[model samples]
Target: MPMKGLIWFRTDLRLDDNPALLDAIDKCDEVAGIYIFSENQWNDHNESNVKLSFLIKNLEILEKSLSNLNIPLITLNTNSFKSLPKDLNNFSVTNNINQVFWNNEFGINESKRDDLSAQILNNSNIHVSRFDDQVIYEPGILRTGQGKPFSVFTPFKRRWIENFDMNFLEIRKPSALKKSISLNNESSKIQYSKIHKVDIDLWPAGEDAAAARLSNFLELKSRDYNQSRNSPILDGTSRISPYLALGILSPRRCILEGMKLNNFELTSGNKGICKWIDEIVWREFYRNIMHSFPKVSLNKPFQDYTDSIKWRHCDNELKAFYEGRTGFPIVDAGIRQMLTEGWMHNRLRMVVAMFFTKNMLHDWRLGEEFFMKNLIDGDFSSNNGGWQWSASTGTDAAPYFRIFNPITQSQNFDPNGDFIKKFIPELKDVSLKNIHQPKQDLFSSSDYPAPMLDLKTSRLRAIEAFKTAREFNNS
Candidate 1:
């Protein structure tokens, strides 16, 4: 009998640099791929429609790619993760798969689902193998001298650099199997609710498109990344997050390409290249935080004391913030950008998140969920990590008192207010001097709303709230 293998596709979607897919190809005579999607799972996780649309498009492209390798892609829909194990087992048994291979997913629910699938498969005499394709290191595997997971990013990054080996980034392309798998008829078309307002054209699907985007960024813009990344107007940063989020591209591919540009220097090279690589490391650090601290995944703040925070719940304020009419140009611009484009600049993300959590005095969880609901590249770890950092409620969080003045952030990052004007067209006629904080008369004359609240007072209010929460925790 031929050795038939099953490749369980998850977030690590691409064939390139995918150890699990390569392993299946190397060990089996024929292989088939399965992608199990759950609408209930997406809803529970607050997944964006834009992202789901992107996923479906990418899967279509992936199906064609796999067909070229003589591996058919079978799409399955389950109600939720609870049903996935049985679904997986039935498929394997029906197909007579002798082995199952998959890349690891680190989320709590994902881990649990994988565990159940593994147990079920092992009991059925089907061998299961998994590999890490997302990060250079498996989450929580790296530790500090005290044997605890490092919460601080700089120290963690230092350790990541020290332990890095070039061999870790090695990739081998898998060729077509000698024999073909006749499972094309079993492949089902993916079904998704299309409700996104974003222009899908902004993000092209497939690994080839992803590779081209990376190449363009490295060739044309990486050297100036340090200077231009902060500016929202400049296309300084690589817009590859959507690709990275879906595993259309791998972190190793990103780092390898980046390092190639930097002459293979991990830390020392063009300042821009090194800084860009640091952002990728930061993503891994957050993943480690998610794995090591399960409470974060449970919707609990990493800092226990933050539980005492008395977060305000106001519908009106939230509505204005959501609609991008908070009268804060930079904040509004950021919100509007995400609403229309399904993505936001990193610097603006921090600025907008800080304004929402600190100045608006709202719950960080709300803002975090909103981002996940709208962003095309909403990686839970990165979104949660960033919101918690802004709200001063998670590992390596900003100091409670270090609230950002959005106007100043606007001046520093979007000096010409071009980004603001581009997103909030009502403010296009507003002068540069007052664009960040338009005068009441300008707001009265235009459709743009006036500043909703006094920044100085709100800043103080947020600080006091944090102080009171700390005192209450201590008492």
Candidate 2:
């Protein structure tokens, strides 16, 4: 009998550069794949339907790709993580698998589920192997001179550069199986309400599409990335984020491809290419943060003092913010874009998040959940890190006093209001000078609402709230 192996697919979906999948193929004569859909767990995590739909589409494409390699994908459905161990163990027994392999995922609940599953498999006399494929540096590998995880990004990045190895970017290509195996398991059906579905067609599914997008960006737009990335109106970004979030493309592949364009120099390269690489590193940094500080994965603030901060609750304002009727053109536009397309530009993400936590005095967790509930590119670590940073509640966060002024940010980034007008049609007729902060007359003539609150006063209020929380904590 051939040595049988099972590959458990999680966030690392693509076959290319997949260490766990490649390892399984190398070790066993015949390999099968399994993907378990934990609906209850996803609901508990506030996963967006848009993200779910994208994931299902990608899974279909991945299944087809795996089939070409003579690997059959077995889909399973379970309500939550608590049931995964039993399901996986039963599947392994029924399939008569000798070994199981998977890539590691970082999250408190995810880690727990994997640990239990590994224990169960070990007890069943089946070997389990986990690979670090999500990040270039395994979570605990990179540390400070003091033998601690670096809390700040600059020093962490410096060490990351210092410790950089060309071997880390090596891409793995799995060889085709010698013979095909028949599996009786059926693919799990995914159904979502019509209201929850977004037009995911905007993002084509598959590894080829992802690779094409990366190639196009590097060849055409990377030179201008640093210069125009902040402008929402311009196609200045790689737009490969959805692929990255879904694991249709790997970070190592992204870095390696980008470095090729920059003469294989990560630090001294085309400024735009280098900056884009920095952004990828930032993503890894957030993953490290989640691994080092698991409390963040559990909805706890990184800065303990932030827990004492009293957040205001206003249903009307919250609804307005959600519906893109907050009367702040830039913030509203960003929110509207996210609602419509299930994605938001990076710069706008920060601006709107800061507006929600500071100007609106809402809890950062609320904004974080809202983003996760809508964004197609929603990754827990990145979303949580961005939110906590905007709210000044995480390690290396912006100081509480550094609140962003929405109107000014709008003028600076979306200067001519092109991005604002694209999402908020009412502002199309408004003059460029008045579009960022439309006058009362313009609002009355058009359907646009006026500024919800005086900017200066709101900034002062948010500052006072932070100060009060810090003072109380000290007392």
Leading candidate by lDDT: 1
Cα error, candidate 1, residue 157 (Å): 0.7
Reference-based TM-score of each model: 0.98, 0.98
Clashing pairs in 1: none
Angstrom error of the Cα, residue 27, model 2: value is 0.6
- Per residue, candidate 2 scores C-alpha lDDT tens digits across 3-29 of 999999988889999988899999999
User: In model 2, which runs have C-alpha deviations exceeding 4 angstroms?
Assistant: 191-194, 442-445
Candidate 1 regions with alpha-carbon error over 4 angstroms = 442-444
lDDT of 1 by residue, 1-475 (tens): 9999999998978888889999999999999999999989998999999999999999999989988999888999888999999999999988889999999988999999999999999999999999999899999988999999999998999999999999998878989988876552375566667698999999999999999999999999999999999999996999999999999999999999999988899889799999999999999999999999999999999999998888888899999999999999999999999999999999999999999999988999999999999999999999999999999998899999999999999999999999999999899998988999998884365889989899999999999999999999888
> How many clashes does each candidate structure show, in the order listed?
0, 0
